[model samples]
Target chain A: MNSIVPDSSFTARSIAENVQSGEWSAVEVLEGYLSQITQHESEINAFNTVLEEEARATARETDKDIAAGKTLGPLAGVPVALKDNLCTNGIRTTAGSRILENWKPPYDATVVQRLSAAGATVIGKTNMDEFAMGSSTENSAFGPTRNPHDLSCVPGGSSGGSAAAVAAGFAPISIGSDTGGSIRQPASLCGVVGVKPTYGSVSRFGLLAFASSLDQIGPFANTVRDAAIVHEVIGGHDPKDSTSISEPFPSFLDDLERGVEGLKVGIISELMGGIDGISPEVIQKTREAASVLSENGALIEEVSIPASLYCLSAYYLIAPAEASSNLSRYDGVRYGLRVSGETLAEMNINTRTEGFGDEVKRRIMLGTYALSAGYFDAYYGKALKVRRLLAENFDEVYSKYDVLLSPTSPCTAFKLGERTADPMTMYVNDVCTIPSNLVGHPAISVPFGSGNDGMPIGVQVLAPPMQEALMYRVASTLESAEK
Target chain B: MTEPISEKEVSHVAHLARLRLSHEELQLFTKQLGAVLEHAKDVEALQLDGVEPMSHPLPMENVTRKDEVHKMLDRDEILDQAPVTEDGRFQVPQILGEQP
Candidate 1:
């Protein structure tokens, strides 16, 4: 019999403690979340596939380990969902694209392996954009995920489903990959704590490559500490990913209580300025967040990032160029979808044409054109220099300030199909988040307050490479201020 | 703004990208991609001849590991996902032929 009654405070931390102390079994914890998913999933549609029996079996094994006197890991019984892009051995993993609707991996992603070692239960694979391409989950081939806050609104993509899963209470934590604003944008739209650890800080061995240089897998949770716990579990160097940082990762959860006292926080001036599409409510909320941090013993000042305004242009070129090269593997023969034709080349062409969605095709065409011989210097090459400018600007600021601040998204959750017809408008949603990706910095989104529309707004905290501990400290400060 | 990409260029890029587009898709994408490129023209307008291009976020290069054999996935299991297979290998359509 369970001794402790689960309440509003029953988070990942509570669930792990209760299971470790034998107050609740791992199976019971899994069952509670499974029930929540079943009750709420139809309207929200966060997950592409829910591993009901698979999660149950894993939970039972954990219970058996406890009975056999094995010690519990940090997230002993916590249920964690995965973005569909992360590969799972023997499980059908689609990157929310029709091409790989039935594809299964031969091995687990490094993060998935690490989570298992840390005693977390695998719950489900959530939905996302086709090849993690768009800013809204509407780009998904299967279907779009409605924001949990308002069933009519979108959960920002391409990691929309992962963000929605955590927001909906279907899982205490979920994993999402950030390429540009994929993780943080959706987290803000969904009113949850989401983190994008420093580039190469977390291994990307089995993450389906979108923009390889920009991609980093991180966690989404209800609290900063929960995100920190999962971040520590999944992060570190892996030989499988050659670009992963080999340095030792610091303990983020241990550093959470350090607070923002005496910390110098710089607000990114351009993001808060009169940028188009920024709701007045979101701007007000970000200004309020600055004031709260100031009252809590931190110094705040506005800092200009001139190159940041150009990040969207540079990131659009860079990410699509990488994606066009990475997605070339979806040819008919080896795995996934195959459309037949007279010759191999024709078959490959037909397969991709039938398999990819409209948004993905537009990007591939744009990317190929950018990399073509005549235009290479004008587009892709120019974008790289702009990336360098963004990096230099960030490095100069990090020397003086511990962390920089910005609104996570220009506005809150957008209604479905609001910006679908216009591609440039959709691309504008990531303007604030793209600079961090360009410079290999770490950034996180913590919910600050709600808009006049009653939807949540997020204030982003960005830090230099390997400074996630300081990043989480600011995140925790904002989280506490909300209370 | 004027269209930054022409329909002829879009068709060429689509073919190069292994995607076959219909007349409607070609026209629609030409306008859409042109608008996107027009927005991206700011980068093109900047004079940055002195700055070197950054291709990746990480600064590391020439990463290599010891040439040691480790456990590999089973060949049969790997081959199981193939659309066409024969003689324990993936099979493909004739590459030299022009048509059926």
Candidate 2:
């Protein structure tokens, strides 16, 4: 039966195209997603707030636009999920934290506005680590988002819910912020295509700040072409975000069929073996992907970025230092939760102590200590220097290779409570993806094969800044070869 | 490994960050933070004499725009989200004096 609204296995491109051709009503597409959500959302815990009424209204509007013979944007009937950090006007925008649990933003984030303008109906706000801090969704103040593949295991995070939503068929496309692999890591675990575009490629105006210098908004989708489409629609210059790159965004979808013939791909050596916590199966799958590209006429080689060894160490210092500064705005006087006290300072202290989770507090303290008077030079300053050296190392490689390859995560999804007790153990998950964020380059994780545990393994393809088309060509190749 | 940071130091940093931790939290953080910091110490081993420190990934020049008035978020809506509001302004506890 060719059911128009059957269970699972839907793509954003198909939905938009079908709606445009009057083959499927926008209502039918939304209901297909809603039916999936109704059946599985409670079990997956992927969303903190499902915008059912709002999504229905938008879907109806999309149908109206099509009936009126109006030209719609690229994503006419697509359902999108947003990481809780990105604001939605008048909707609760909790970054999966206790503090902002009931907080509603008065305005939409720039990304939200752009998605709406592109005719995508935002179905829900997905759960995430409290302030997007953890590698697993365990740091979420609500509850952890479980992997759709294995209910007992984690979907990688802080963008866990965004990935899980797409994996669980709640949404075909989703938006998440990647500070240090938040998008790609979870996408790898959930067997979806996740992208972290060039640092300033997407506007960050509405994304709740985690580490402003490192945070970049990206998408998770069922295919590389869909990811490229979503990326193009949401990317480009915005007057609202001062840091947004003013350059014109290239048509990423056009490059999908361009293919990776005669392209140079480097397997990042430090991430492949030199770093700790990488599993044999993950490495094997990544190597197999490299050969697959080689078979498809791509040149493959082993290249070393020595500074990648220190990226995790340096990132902890640099990201936390920036976070400490960004998260200070959560005082009781403004939006969100506030606990009372006699004095103003005491009120501020009490508010933060009760509002934030243990992981967030740990980061705040770590950041404060690093930026404090005595330890500033030794920790934060030195970390900044290491960041530069790592960027320089990657740049040296970029001069030779069109893109770099590595595992998106160290291993497949660990059991829910496996690494929650130890922050250091969980931090190792970002070892491969952090280097790209540090260098402000674009990267994507393509689901290549399965690990020994039967969980999906994702092979990451990274390119130099503004080279997403080149990166997507390789990712598209890997995705097609998987079948 | 021995603790690189003491409980007292953790409390001090916590105070600076405006987070009041429980006695148990202080104990846990001191041990956990010490190990994380010890790992971060690897950066100190790098010979970074001439490498210029990079704070932002892109070489961003100061972005200036003509000071023009634009539509802003409604003042009432902003106030409505505040935890404490009075007369359309965010209300806070006293700044200078002790508890009245």
Candidate 3:
């Protein structure tokens, strides 16, 4: 059995091919991954819940199917990890918060259902920022998921665990939710490919709503082609989730090797030279990527999005405001942990106090205040207006450019506990990403550079709503060229 | 121009939001919130003279759907999540001046 390593480049396709040809047994694959989790999970702190017996049984069944000449799906017998937020039947689906620590969903999320139907064996649930609220995994109720690249450093969250798992080879690929770049940011930091599908393309049913309008489920893989393969399986309509569109799904795998020839790539000048805290190395890498695209026959053009300056400000208001409402469902009334006191108010207070982490409480308070009667017009409503303007600006740019390019994050993974005390500083980490969420467009984060600290930094590719295949083609070309 | 918001207003909002704060938290959040209001102040300063406020991204009109019978969750499952419940209703302490 091969041990899982940080740079284990064998993808789901390669592993499946070996397993199907009887070259590698499904039992061996599961056992190998199990051994990997046992060896590395302590150092990485990636998984919050591990399903060892369940995975072993599934692997046995897969072996039986192969013996019987069963028609195996593309990812049959392949081990994949999942972010904790995606609900699994009878499994603890904690969204990295104490409130739902013991809450087991009665049904599987659409994505989970699809993955199972596609013959992928789910190994475990991974850690994330509490309620997918923070940019770092430090906010997880269980504990922070450490970066695989540097043990002492943080894993970018709220899909940090998923990214870290894929990077560290705990699993070949994992599904992660991207709301405000949760998937891609971590992918960039961990040197993996994380793609956030266009809004409303994937079903959000059973994804514990953290900003319903912006939340999307995507795959994190070591290779862009692997990510595309996983995305195609999980991308489609579901009657269970009304937000999911009944549109024809694109053949992401079929378009994996498509180059960006004659494509118009917009280099957002403001994102490149605009921010103060961004490092020179990030800018250099971005410029280099732009040049490569230009060299590859892509028409690179400088684009300015002036309203992007207010994206962070707008995000804070809108995300918190939506979070406050979404989190209201967690009040000791629904399936989760509950604390009690003599009075009703005291009971509610005690339950929330013990159940919620500091960051979740802080955001809830901020959101509640922002959406309060007198303050709604001033904060939430105004933010909505700015969000519109930003979306319109992106629309105008996309009318000309095929896709917009910028650094995925301002910087790479910082040391663990670096920004725990300073919330404002932490919020700035999502400056480039928050715009995509606000505009309800799709974006992907692919590794482009090694930061000054030698950690991975990602380049973000933004496309207009439902233009994910276009973004995927450009990203794949860049991904191929880098290799 | 943004009108000055009082600390009392913040306190009231906090109450509605169910936040239990120390004296220090209140003071700190107030000052920080006040400083951040400048952006909103600037946004309010915009000449959105004829622009109607947008609620959603898509230009959706009045959407009405037919009501259909769906299987509601079982009483046991519904009650399974409550911190405390009695007689199929969520339980809370009876308030002297409040209605259930």
- TM-score for each predicted model, relative to the true structure: 0.97, 0.98, 0.94
lDDT of 3 by residue, B14-61 (tens): 666656667787776666555545545656555554555554444444
Off by over 4 Å in 3: A1-5, B1-7, B31-45, B52-54, B58-78, B85-92, B95-100
Docking class of 2: medium
Give per-residue lDDT, candidate 3, residue A221: 90
Give the top-scoring candidate (DockQ). Answer: 1
Q: Model 3: which docking level applies?
A: acceptable
| CAPRI level of candidate 1 | medium
How do the residues A66-175 of candidate 3 rate in per-residue lDDT, one tens digit apiece?
88888677788889999999999888899998888888887789899899888789999999999998888999989899888888788798899999998888899999
Write model 1 residue lDDT over A1-483, tens digit each, in one string: 111112353678888888888889999889988998888898788999999999999999989888888888889988999999999999999999999999999989999999999999999999999889988899999999988888889989889999888888889999999999899999999888989999999999999999999999999999999999999999998999999999898789787988899999999988987456777788889999999899989999988888887898898898989889999999989999999987898999999999999999998988998899988999999999999988889888888888999999999888998999999999999988889899889999999988888888999999999999999999899999997
Best by lDDT: 2
lDDT, candidates in the order shown: 0.90, 0.91, 0.82
Listed models, DockQ each: 0.78, 0.75, 0.41
DockQ of 1: 0.78
Chain B TM, every candidate: 0.89, 0.89, 0.79
lDDT score of residue A398 within candidate 1: 80
lDDT value, candidate 2, whole model:
0.91
The sequence of per-residue lDDT tens digits that candidate 2 reaches over residues A67-166 is 9998788899899999999989999999999999999999898889988998899999999999999988999999999898888889999999999999
